[model samples]
Target: MLNLLQIEFHKMRYNRATKIFLIIYFCLFFSITLFSSIRFNLGEINFQLAEQGIFNFPYIWHFNTYFAAILKIFLALVVISMISTEYSNQTLKQNLIDGLSKKEFILSKFYMIIALSLASTILIFLVSLGLGLIFSDFNEINIIFSEMGYLGTYFLKLVAFFSFCLFLGVWIKRSAFVIGALFVWWVAEGIIKGILTFRKQKYGIKDQISQFFPLEAMNNLIKEPLTKLGIVKSSIGVVNDVNIYWYQILIALIWTFIFVWGAYFLIKKRDL
Candidate 1:
């Protein structure tokens, strides 16, 4: 596995698009962290968020994780571009022709996905720790660690999303079409959830059902802090309350498995 991952990394090391996207990805991610933390530290944000300790010790984990997760799409685009470029360049076929088995080839890509996801998670963790230590007024260590679950949730969500992206990349083999489908899927989920939310009271549709939607289920792993934004109800234009369900983690893992299994099936069954 290590040798396979090394080969994958070598491929990425020479890919200009992968490097460019990574640069853009980290820049946007850190910019968000800095801007949000600085504004809150300077008392420039809305009173509601300020009162909620948006950048404070314990809550800093949640705030940073959520914002950092926003950058996952950039990583997904990089993954898609990398995979699709291989198809375009016939590198995947060359590797197999050079004696790499089909399973190893696909597993190498999955290893890359896991590594990238972990790297992103670690970046978020470091930034959150730095920001919390610098500006947080709390001195208790327990408070700083209390909301750490969000970090894990953020990691799982990234893995799940990227797994789906991997499946898309292999199945479509076209970066543009795969990315477009991703956008449509995201928007479609929001639209479907919105419609279901609108008819919730009439049909007794529960909020939990929305979590079953692939993206929605991954996102639901981290419930929005009610006091931070206070816009969940306002934006949704519904009075429905969202609670953090622990099982959503399990649901996300299941979806991740299915998506990865789908990728494996497609890669193994299809001609390279």
Candidate 2:
């Protein structure tokens, strides 16, 4: 596994565009802390986000992970670029000629995906821990470590999403079109859910069915964290409360397997 990742990173190391995108991705990720300085002044209602206690111990874990997942699109671009270039530069053919088996090639890509996800997960843990220590009201060790499960969900979300991007990149072979394909899949899921709910008197079936979709499975890992804030209800807007369930992690894991396997199957069969 270590050797596979080293080979993939070696390729990325010399790719100027990949390096630039990675730098930009991390910069945007760290910039998320800038939310602490956000202010909202609506006539007689003045509010500052930093005072909202979102940076509180357990809450900071969920908040940071949610936004880190959002910044994942930048990494998705990197994933697509790597796969697209492998084909465009004829590296895939060259590697195969140089004695790399098809299974190892796919394994190498999957290893790279896991490495990126693990690194991002560690970054979130450190950043959230730092912010919580500085700003949280409770210093109890239990409270500090309470919501660490969010980190797992965040890691799973990245792996699944990037795997989907990898499948698209290998199948489509263009970064722009891969993104377009992602958007189309997202829209299709929404449309399918809409049809399932068209003038229906119930939402249970719709919700249950939508949960099976790839993107929906990933989204279920982390529901919106913003609505959990007090100011959102008192000032921002009325919002519904969301529950965090452990089963969503399993759903995401299954989708990740499907995506990675699908990509591997494609490369195995294609006459590279």
Candidate 3:
């Protein structure tokens, strides 16, 4: 099992798609940090204002929330490609024929996803922390860590989202379709939810429907206090009373098990 995992890791390290994803991930983080640093240095942002307790903490919070949200999309792409590429290349079949158990194969892939998610989260957090230190001396580090309390919940949500994407990739066995469907689902669902909210005369039933989408639920899991931007009501009508941490952990686990188990069952029952 350990040897199989090593081989999997080696293949991932050499995969061109994985390399491109890492580059894109780093570029996104670097761009965010660069923009924030420039804004701070240009006198466009007043440090005293931040220190005066007017918008300091919320500013940091908003940055973190937006950063996480953007990174989530890239992470989803990485997950999809990781699973899809193996099947597309017929490498998964070769591995299976070489004495790798179905359980080991699936578990290895899932473990890699978890490791990647955690590593990306930590990388972003550290980069943001360094930027905060470089850009200001206003004790934003504490605020960053405070906001980081959502990392674990968000990690679980990523796992669930990745699991679903993996299942889709396996079921369809087409990279273009899997990637296209993910983006379409992400954009269309949000748009539909928005239209529903706009059409609602009083109630928020449309928003409730949107809340069930994996992306929305995942965002709710990493509920950062900073990005509320005065939007009071949650998509599910939970309002300020929502416990995103608990909700994310619960739903992510349930969905992760369901999708991964379903995929495993299908793999075992079907000929690859």
Q: TM-scores, in order shown?
A: 0.88, 0.91, 0.78
Evaluated with TM-score, which candidate comes out highest? 2
Tens-digit lDDT track for model 1 on 180-271?
A: 99999999999988888888877987655788888998888776654454455466655534456668888999999988889889989987
| Model 3 vs. true fold: TM | 0.78
Give per-residue CA lDDT, model 2, range 39-64, as digits (tens): 77899988866678888888888888
**lDDT measured at residue 46 in model 3 versus the true structure, 0 to 100:** 51
Residue 122 Cα positional deviation in candidate 3, in Å, after optimal superposition? 1.3
Query: Tens-digit lDDT track for model 3 on 1-272?
Result: 56656867888888788788778977886776565444244467553323322233424544454456567667677777877888878988998888888888778878877777778667756665665554444664466456555556656766777888878877776878998887788898789877878877467444556566667766677654532533333444454533554555666677788888877887888888
Off by over 4 Å in 2: 38-47, 198-206, 233-241
Against the unseen true structure, what C-alpha lDDT does each candidate score? 0.82, 0.86, 0.67
